[model samples]
Every structure is written in structure tokens, then in C-alpha cells.
Target: MNPALIERLQAVDRQAESMGRGERSAYLKQQAAELGMSLATLYRKLEAVAVKPGRKRRSDAGKSELSLDEAKLISAVLMEAMRRNGKRLMAVRQAVEMLRANGKIEAARIDEETGEVLPLSESTIIRALREYKLHPDQLLQPDPVSRMKSEHPNHCWQIDPSLCVLYYLPRHGKDTGLRVMKEEEFYKNKPKNVVKIEQDRVWRYTGTDHASGTIAVRYYFGGETSANLCDFFIYMMQAKQDTLKDPFRGVPRMVMLDPGSANTSAAFKNLCKSLDVHVQINRPGNPRAKGQVEKANDIVETAFESGLRFTEVNDIDQLNGLAERWMRYYNGTQIHSRHGMTRYQAWNKIKAEQLILPPPADYCRELAVSAPKEAKVSPDLEIRFGGRVYSVKDIKGVLVGQKLLVAKNPWETDGARVATFDADGHETWVAVPQVVFDEMGFRADAAVIGEEYKAPSHTESQQHAKELDKLAMDAETLEQAAAKRKGKAVPFGGELDPYKHQEDTLAARNTLYIERSGQQMDYNRMEVAEQVLSKVEMAKLLKPRIEAAGGDWKQAVALITKQYPDGVAASQLEAVFNQLKTAGRLKLHKTA
Candidate 1:
């Protein structure tokens, strides 16, 4: 293996090759004796040092006995048997065996020389799976993500909630104090201890500005709830009093968050609707969509919450206060890697129009409870809400009689927002102003009475109705259909019988009457007559008045006798009763 030995062997081989066959053999024997090694050993050393041509590749070297399709079937079976955490529950051998038993895969090769039928082994199948990139290891990797950006600060924000495993606030007597949850006291073995303080488990809510990477964190006592999420969101939106300490506050154009129940709650969505903030809920099982807030949670845990172990914390308020202070310092001083500037500096670049200040906290809280109500778009392209009508003519793709979700717009006193879906099926809130009316109770935008005339544009419903008319009436257009029928065409091509049910009922009744009476009934003499109230009925009606009148029935009886000697007509009872009351005949005393 030494360079000198290799050179010596090469020289001996060159000299031996120059001699005749018998002389070359004698020369190699002489060299082997001189080297004190056997002739076979010398030949082996020479062969090791000799330069040989590269190994000849077969015509089907990369081809496998297991076909790509068969390998894919095996891979799919293994993948289906994998846990969500990417751990494979079924190995390649087990999967291959099961697939073979199920007759789902047939990967075999026939030897060209021997003509032998050879089935692919597990190793061959696994190799083919790798070659075709069908293995679970290759398929279960995290999806590739592209960099996302916002045009300006507050353009987009990401929020996420995480349970703080390090600490919990347990109530001692009447007051709650921060307590560290050690593994020894609260582990998998101690289920009761975990449940005992379930209500007291601390949850950290984190929000991050996508463009500036500004972070806002708040600690809550309980788990993720709509109230806590809304509270944290309001805190992020509301301007801080101490601007010198923290100034990152404004309603974002869009908010990206995980699709948790609390995050998708009606109250939280209503809050966003009122603020004109777009809620972008990431798809389930896709946390990377809101990776900013997820990372912020980790940063808060490491840089902020980790120090809580050394410091004293009394209650959730104090803990939040400490968190707020840390967030302000972190955002104001720490330079963000994305922009190479502090978060405050980056956020300060926001234009006045882009930075929309939120309403007061109380108004936001009120708005949170204002869930969207379904309102139908009227024929006049309007929706009624809160005793007022709002015009939907400006809303794109709006149609008459179409239902829309509407909620109160907190920014506008009399305006409401209509929840609409984009082409991508994402819910968006559009602010719709209330219709203004003149003093004459007419629309302010209405055309003048005589000077000018304005014809409203045709709605989607009208266009569809035209199409429907063509289909239903078998005509080229609505005008043709109208001219054909002269405004008297019945629906369904006039094939429908409108009074068939009524006719059937009358026929059945006639048959029953004839069967029971053994003859046709006389319809000409039948008549309906109104009946008058009986004396007993009149007395019952006047009983309450008579009782209130100190059991004086003489006045009531005298009036009834004078009004009608027979009986009082039911239609005239109200008028006659009122006359008796006004005539001081049925006066009732009021008790103190």
C-alpha cells in the first residue's frame, strides 16, 4: 500500500511485460524470491497496485424488480400506518408482507438469462421506494414556505396562544399568588394535581406585527377563551398612555391566527368586523402560517417568562404588568433582523391613513357582543338593520333577495358592515353607510321628479331571471316571451291546474252528502245567517261589571231591555256596551 512499494511493483511489472512469456514467468519468480515473498503474493501485490478500467455498468443497473407503481402502493400503506408525528408504525417488511398478502402489489422480475421468475424482496421494495421518492420519510416533511411580507406596519398581524407550563397562579385562602409547577408535584403520575389547578393554569397570548416584528404579550389566568383573546387583542389595538415606553398600537389591516375555537368565535370575529380588521384564520394543522406569533411565544417564554422564576409575582395583574414592561423594552431596543432597525422605528414609518386608531375600550367591548345578523338584500338593493336601511348597490356581486351577514360598524355611528366572501371564499367585512333621506321622506340620491329620470341598473337577479324566463317559456328572450303571452302566460307552460285540490274537495263533499241522504242535496235553499247573543251570554258578559258595580244588576237589565227586547246582536255588543258605560249605567268604583 506504500507509494514506494507501488512504484517498485509497477517497475517490476513493466520489466516483466517486456520479456517473452517463459522469460516473464522466470523474471516474476526471481522478483518474488528477491522480495522474500511467494510468487502468488507478489502477483497479488502487483494486481493491487495496477491501474484497472472502471467497473462496467449494466444496461439496467438503476432499474428495480419492484415497479414504481408497486413501490408507491407499499409506500402509501406505510404512510397510512404512520402517526401524525411522523413516526412510522409499520415497517417496510411489515408493509410489504401485508400488501403482498392483500394482493395489492406484484413486483417481480424474470431473469433474462435463466428465465426464472423472481419476486422482489422487502429490501428491493424499500430501495425502489427511495429511488422513486415515495418513502414516508421523503413525503412527510414540512411543506415548503415562501417568505411573506406586509406593505407597512399594522398591515398584518399574527396572534397565537400557548399554555405556560412553568408556572400557575393558585388561590391561597382568598388571594391568588404565582406558584411554580414543579415536575415532582405535577407530573403524568399526578392527574389530580393537574386537574386541581386547571382553572389556574397560566396562558400566554402573543401577537406580532408581520412587517415590523413588534411583539405584544399578555398573561391570563385561565385557558384560551374568547374573553381573554378579545382582551389581549384590545390591548394590542389600544394606544398606550406612556408613549415613551411603548407606542405600538393600531388596528391592523389583517390578522393571521390559528383556527382555534376561541379565535374563530363569533364575538372575536364581531370585534374584527366592527374595527374593519380582516381576520385571516390559517388552515388547521398549519401553524407555520402564523409562525411569527409562534416564535414570539417562544421568545416570551425564554427571554421574559424564564426570569419569572427568579422574580416575585403576586397575581395575574402583576405578571401582566411585568410582561408589558418587558415587551416595551424589547420592541423599543431590540433591532429586528428583517429590517435591521428597532420595531418602534419600523412601525413609526406607518402613514396616517394606514394607521387606523381603534375605538375606546368600552366601545370595542360593546362591539364584541354585536354578532353578525343575517339580512336579506331587498329588491331595491337595500338591507334593513337597526331600524334603518343601508344601500348595497356599491357592494360588488350583490343581488336582490340575497342574504348577507351584517354587523354594527364601530367607527361609524350609523353605518353597518356587511360580511361578504371573496372569490377565494374568505370572509371580508365591507362598511355600508346608512341611506340618507330628505325632509320629504324620500331618498336624497333620488332623481328629480320631472327634470331628470334615472333608471336603476339591472341586478344579478334580473339577469338570471331573464335567463330563467327563456328556459321556462321556451322563448328567445323576455320580450319575446311577453309578446307571445300578452302578459297572461301561466307558469310551467300553462300545464298546471291551480284549483284541482279545491275541485276534488267539493266533489268528495257532494258524494258524501248524497250517500248519507240517499239523494242530491238542495243547494238553492241553503243559506248562512248571523246569530244574536242569548240572554245568558249577555248576563255572563255583564257579570264582571255587575260585580264591580256592587252587585247592582237593575241598571244593566234596564239598558239591555231598552236596547233590544229580543237579544243583542254580536256585532252591536261592543257599541251597546260602550253606550252603557258612557251612560253611567255600568260605572265601576276604583278601590284604594
Candidate 2:
């Protein structure tokens, strides 16, 4: 029998052993037909190697007089020879030669009747290897085929970034100036370095729908980055062409991607979360998870990019224009391999019924990548982002240096949206401030209102400015006074300590005396302030100590010394401990 036929029969037999009697019979019949064998021949093929119970071996089954142990030792020696020499042990003749060279045959028992030494046969060795189930071709086995599939259009979209090299005209010194020109002037102006023959490497982002094979490709001059990915994603979702229409318009149910720098960014993850889209990262070392996009890249290299050799591409825009045209031709005209129809046609067949479009304009903007950053609000209620100052108006009571979340406008960088986060990490929109510039150029908190000038006014604006200046001066005075009174104040500053001066009105009230209390019932505010602490203010200072100490006073003392390094006196530490205990904030054991 042919080796392939025998192998097929063995595989079928193993599978059949696990089936029910009826199923086994039906399976065997079907396999017989598929293998172009008669039922009797298949059954005979299966029975030839069937396992037998309690079968006795013939006394002379092996002509060789070697025992089973000696046979195994000979086989081991043969395998070692092949391994050491980096060769295959396929023939019994090779094994026999190795065994004789190692002097194993010299000790073999002679045949009693023939008076000659018995030789090892090829069938005996082959049968022994088969009986032990060792496979010589194990390393040559093919990888299991991937069965990943999408059921409908936009069910899964694969996105990837690739780099391609092409030729473009280099810009001259004059051509590189910052100036807006007409289309004809921009493209027709011949640069002195037109034929410089420099390699123009461009980053290309491609997204492909798994089911319908619809694709969208975009080109950029920069490397793979979060901004580039976001821009291309937006273009792929919104831009429409007359030839291809909007075959790849809907938001994918799940976007599959490899673990690339741009794809794994926080901005990208945030965008997916905002859009309510699931993201799937390919397994490490398994790039075939997004095979559709990879195939599309191969097509671009072979079909679209090869066609660009004859065209004159001068800039990134021109390259993108060519890519846009090529994408339409590829997606709208060429037939897909699996679907046997144009991707556009296949997509349109089910898109209207199955695909889900993106959210409304406002929601889409919210879902777009904003690259959020946490920043401190300045004293003037302003935050700096991207080298521009943005001022929040009507923020009189908001604390200076408070952390606020600032995110850029996805489509532009001129201004950003500011938000305030609570203790629970919930963000609420606070302001959408405008960029500030002034007579001296980009002054802080000065709104840029284009080319308009107005006469000075004595309105609320000036009054607010004056109030801000007064507060600033008072703060500076307090800081200087705190520096002079450091030992009596807190560690960093005396800004919130009790010894810091009380409010002006409160101090005046404490100095006043009523006629009924002419015996001098003066309220010493300083003594009162030392013992009284608002729950909020008290918690703010004690929480860290409580957490560090974990309710152990000695541990807290050590931690304080480690943190402060100036060495707090034991008496002062005990006083604060007792104060905190009386306030029901913490318990310090008396033993300490």
C-alpha cells in the first residue's frame, strides 16, 4: 500500500474510535468515498494494523538472536549517530552499519540451525519506530490555518500603518518660505533642487473591512504617531469619493490592530472608549490576526505604488491625491478574492442593513482624539497649552495652582477645552477658553480679538484686575512674613497655619470690647485658632500622617522625622497627637 494511503487510513481509524457505532460506520463510508477506496478495501486497510489482545510472539520472529534490551541499545546507538552527524536514520542498512561499527553484532548469538549470525531487517526497525509512534517529519508539520472571519460589513475593521519610499521634488530655500500661494503657483514653480533624487519616505495608514474587503488608505509625510493615526481615521470615516462612494463609512464594531506605538497610545484607547467601540490587539508574535490589512498593504505595494513610478509626485498632498484615486479604483472596480465581487458592491449589498454609522457631529468630536493633559491653573485663572495662554473668566473663588484637565481641539490646536475633576475623578466641563495675545505679543490672560482697538474703560474688568492685584500683594506679604516666622509655622509655608494672621475684619472684632463686658472679656483669637480646625482642613493635614503611621504612634514619629528631617520635639508631637485624638481623627496608644 502507498504510504499516504496507509497514513490516511490510520488517521481515519483513530477518529472513528471516538465516534458512536452508527457514526463510526457512516464516517468510514464517507471517508472511503472521499479517498477513492471501496468500503471493503478501507475496512481491510483498517484491520491490517488493528491492535490484538494477548497475542504471543513467535520464538523466531526476529532472525537476530539479540534480546529486546540489546535491540533497544542498538536503536539508541543508531539515533545518536544520526543526531551527531546531523542526518536522518531512514534505512535499516544504515542502523546495521552503525551497530556493527560499535561492535554490538560481534556479541550477537549465532542462529542455532544455520550456524550464521542473524542480520537486522529494515522492516523490523521501521515497525519498531512505528509501534513507538515516533515521527521523523514532526518538525515539517504546517501551521494550523486561521479561521477568523467577520459576519457582516463593518463588523471588524483592521487598521495598520506602513512606510513606503518614493521620489519627490526637494524644496529650495526660497520655496520653503511661509507663504500662501495659488494652486498653479504652488505646483508649477520649478525648484532649483527639483531633480535632487532624494528618498521620500511616507507613512501610509490603511483600514480594511474584514467581511466586504472594503478599504481606505491615507498618506502622510510624518512617521507613525497618534496625531497621524487620528487624522487618517477621521479621513477614512468621513471623506467621500464619487467613484468609490462611502463603502467604508460606518464605525466598526471592533477594530483589530497590532501592538504598534500609535495604536497602543492612551489617546487611541480614549477615542475608542468615547466612541463605544471595542478594540482588539493581536496576540504578540501573531501578525496574522489582522491579515486583511496586511494583504491590503501587499496590494498597495504591488498595484498602486508600482503604478506611481510613471507619475510626477512633488509633495505629500500630491502623493495622497494619487492614493485616493488608486483606492477608488481598487475598491470600486477590482473583484475581491473571497467575495468574488467588487468590495464596493459587496459592501453596498449589506451596509445599509447591517452597518452602524458614527455618532452625531458633537459626539464625534468628543470621540475624536483630544490628547488630554493635567495642568495647574495660574493665579490669573489661566492655563498654558501648546505655547498659548487660555484664560478662564469669572473664576474668582477657584484656588490657584489647582489641577485642571486640558485637552486640545482634535481638528485644531489654537484653543482647548478645560475641565475640573472632583475627588472621585469625575470631570465636568468648566470653560472653553480663547487664546490670548497682546500689544507686547502673547501676554498672559489677554484675549486676542483680531485687529480691533477700544478706548480704556473703568468697568468691572478694571475693578477685577485691581482686586486680583490686591490679593497678589497680600499673598506676597504673607509669604515674606512666613519666611521670617518659619520656626513657628508649618514645614513648607505658614500659609494655612494658625499663627498666620487672621482676616482683617476678624482681628478687629477680636480687639473690640462690649460695654456689658467692660471687665475685659477680650476674645483672644490666636488661642482660639490654635485649637479649632474645620473638618476639611484638619483631614487635609492629618490624613497623610494617619496613613503613614497605620495607627502606630512610634511608626508615625519615625515617619515624621524621616519626612521632615529637622526633628520634631517629642513634646510637640505628643501635643498634636492628643489634639488629633480629641478631634476623633486618630487614636494614639498611651504606651508610646
Candidate 3:
């Protein structure tokens, strides 16, 4: 019984005691009825001033069919067996098969008399999986989908890229010496197993209208990238079909896509914003938020891509041509399942007046894929923009050493624009780089100084755009350089020399400064002192370098000062350097 309930019963008993004998009997009966117990039971319960406690049941009596550790192991095995993709409840069955095959269940302790192993049934495995609570990605079913409905055709679009299993010949790199591999060999080799895996893969990008269920797709020879997304988006926005009068082509109000690197990239986001389109990211691990396009992707896989496997797809052009033919049929002929009409029919119902087309070429050029960066004009009447030299021929030697803004497109860096801003932050001079393409279509330098022009209002700095550009350039340079040199260079700190020790010390100090955002203030002392390597720390760091140079401390000083090209670290290390010299550990080559 609850303590509160017992207190109420005791209070009623006290009230009964205050009444006469006849009244007490009536009150007891009333209290018994209120307590939902028989009068005799109530009397017995009240008579016992101190109640006897009932014996507690053992928690592990019946529930100990499987130990917690054993259940966890089984659940882990099930998660591994199923991985991230399988039908619902399929993992439970797979878990049983795996456990039985591995003899894990047989290894369990058997009952003494019955000679039966511990429970390892389908239900038990299912219970374990639930109890373990695997991540949504690890489970067959993902998180729930909740997407808003669009009222018009151009209101929203879903864009995503999926790999096509069918193999295709490249425009180049399909050497005559190498024969086309069979489909079996292609599927047998995973991406990690193949050389130049991206080149080996083909991708299909889809843009499905939210309201009308109309889909526009584009094929690419290589795996998906931000460049592929931009080209595909442009294709969908500009494409027209003769089969259907006025095909689905427009700048949608909103475009929903997965949070993949390519979709969420700065360039891609800028492209969408420039076109006045809002971007909505589908929740991570939840693909069903874009169900329409996911269904379209399935259709492309089963209906379209399957047909391409039988034909000779020599290049991306051939594949795109075939895809266009399929799209024509899908848009004009096939009836939409939900609307009970063809996609084209449903799209046309909205009328042409309701749709919005893409902006003109000149306006589109301003919104082209590019990121902003600040560059200072060098003494040569040019700025180092996107790792290449650029200048304005119209105004040579006009803005030397002045700060300028550079808008670089990693996909098309040769045509990057440079602009100089005045005191009011308005662009004074804007020019595009006159890039020279090498024999292999790589940039050498600007052929002629670029011409001046007006900068657009949409110019803004891109997040980590320069880093991305640098990475791309580094990859290309590495690939080219590696072909000639088979051996790698000695990395920093890998050399067995005194210079390495000093280099490591300088690197650590630099990292500390960068991490802490420069000098820190001593609030109690009301003094500001720069965070520099301590004298003891510097001595310890230079000990190896001094020994390596045969006890010559000057070598360590030279190595340390080399790190500070602008003399900042040299000035900071002066105090530590003086202390070392005074201790006679370091020699003063030119003393007073």
C-alpha cells in the first residue's frame, strides 16, 4: 500500500473513534466503502498498528534468460551483419543465422537438467536491437520525412545526383590497347579497388518539380562534383524539348537538396542566391524528405539506365542524347501516378504566365559561379589572383601596391575578375584576366593585361574559396610532378639535423600564437606581453640543434631567425637569445 493511502485510512479510523458505538460502526462502513475494501478487511488493516511487509520478488527470476553482456554482443553482431542497408526485421533473422553459424549461441551455458542453450531467438535479437538503439544510418529505416507541399510548379525543386551502374567510354583515356571491361568486372570492383575511380564512375543529376512531379536530368562522364551540379542546374533551367510545347524550365523559388559537399558548397549556394532561389537542405540521414526526386532516381535506375547497358555509350554526349529521348517520353507521354495526368499536362495546367524563366545572359554572367578574395597589387602593376598573375592593360602602373578585390571561379579561374575599391567601398576599376592556355589547356599566365570594367553589386567573399582553389592546384601540380619524380621529399622534422629542432620549436610557437589569437593581457598587472617561447623552453628546443651543429650555437640562432622572414620572431626571441649568450652556452661572435 502507498504511504499516502495508509495515512488517509488512518485518518478515517481516528474520525470513527471520535463517534459513538453505533455512529462508529456506520463511519467504519462508510470509510471501508470509500477505501474500496471489505469492512472486515478494513477492520483487520486498522487493528494492526505496525503492518507486516510482503516479501519482495527477485528482479532476475524470470528475466535472466539472457545476460546483459550476451545480449549486447548479439545486438552488435546484428548491427554489423545488417550494416546500413537492409529490409526491416531482416537484420533480426540475419543476426540469428550469424550467431548460429559462428557457434556463439552454442557456446552459451546450457541448463543443468534440460541441457538447453541460452535464449537466442528472433524476438530476443529484435529486443536487443531496440535496447541498443542503433543510429538511424545503421538501421534499415531512416528518420521520418516531413516536407512542405508546393502550390506551384516553379515554387520548389529537388536536386540530387546518383551514380549510374552502366559503364561508358570517355571522350579520351579509352586507350586502344585496353578493351572495355565487362559489367561483372565493373560491379565487382568497389571505388577503393579501382584506379582513377572518379573517371570510372558516371553520374546522373535530377531536378524534379515539387508541384507537377516533372523531372529534368543530366548525365556526366565523371563522379558528382560542384561543377557537375552547376552545369546540370543550368541544363535544367535552359533545356527545351520539341515533343512537349514549352517544357519545364525555370529558376525555381526554392530548391531542396541533400547536405552533400557539392550541394552545400559556397559556389553552389552563391549560384542559387544569385538566381533568387532559396536553398532548403533535407535533414541528414533522411532522404525521404525529397521523395519525389528519390522516386525519379529509382525510375532512372530501373527504366532509363537499364536500357543504356545494352547499347554502346561511347561518350557523355551519346548518354545525354539517350537520356533526352527518355525524358521526352517521360514528360510528354507517361501519366503521373499521383495527379492522374502526364507531367507536361500537369505543368501546362499552371499556365505559362505563372512560371518564371532564367535571367538574360548579361545578368547571368554577374551571377556566375565565383567567390570574392582580397588581393594587393604587386609592384609589377599586377595582382597574384588564383595563383596566377593578372593586371589591367588599360591602366598599367596605375594602382601598384594598392589593395584590390579579386573574384575567382575555381571552375573557370582563367576568366577571374579583379576590382579596386575607393574610400567609399565602391569599385573604381574592374577587369578580367587575359589568361593564356598552355598546350594541355592549363593556364600559363595572362597573355595581355585585362581591360577595365564596372564591378557588379553581387560580389561577396566566398567561405574558404581560396583554400579550395589552392587544394585543386596542389592536386594538379602533385600529379604532374609525381610522374617525373618517384620519390617524395623529406617532410619537415624528418631530417636528422639541428635545423629540424629549431624548425619544430618555431612551428610550435607559431601554432600557439595562431591558436590563442596573438598576445594575451595580464588583467591584474594591467600589462600586455606577447606570448613568446620562454628562455628555458627556447634552450630546451635548441639543445638538439646546437649538438647537431657540433656545439655551435650560432647555427641554432640562424635557424631560429630564418623562421621570422619579417623579423617579428627575431625581435621576440632577442631576450631569450641574450640570456643564452650571457650563460656562455651561445658565443657572441662580434662582442664590444
C-alpha local distance difference test of each model: 0.85, 0.64, 0.65
Best by the TM-score measure = 1
Q: Give the deviation of candidate 1 from the true structure as CA RMSD.
A: 24.3
Residue by residue across 1-592, what tens digits does model 2's lDDT show? 8888778778888899999999999999999999888999889989986565797999866443445555566556555656533476545566667667887753344567998876646665555444443333332234476688788887888899986544333455534221222344334345533223223335678889888898788876557888777677666656366524655676667788888888888777666544445778887666667878999988887888777666555566777787887877788889988979999888787646565665544445555545567778676667787677777544434456777666654334365666554577654444466655667776654445886654433345566665564353443454554454553544334355555456765877777666574476778565433344433444456566665555655454454444445533433555655554554434554333
Better of 1 and 3 by TM-score: 1
Model 1 residue 331 distance off true place after TM-score fit, in angstroms: 1.4
In order of lDDT, best first, we have: 1, 3, 2
Kindly give the number of clashing pairs for every candidate. Answer: 0, 0, 0
Question: How does each model score on TM-score?
Answer: 0.71, 0.39, 0.43
Indicate the TM-score of model 3. 0.43
Off by over 4 Å in 3: 1-82, 86-144, 172-181, 188-193, 196-201, 239-246, 309-314, 351-354, 361-366, 372-592
Q: On residues 541-577, what C-alpha lDDT tens digit does candidate 3 reach at each position?
A: 6666456534556555664455433433424565544
Best by lDDT, which number?
1
Pairs of colliding residues, candidate 3: none
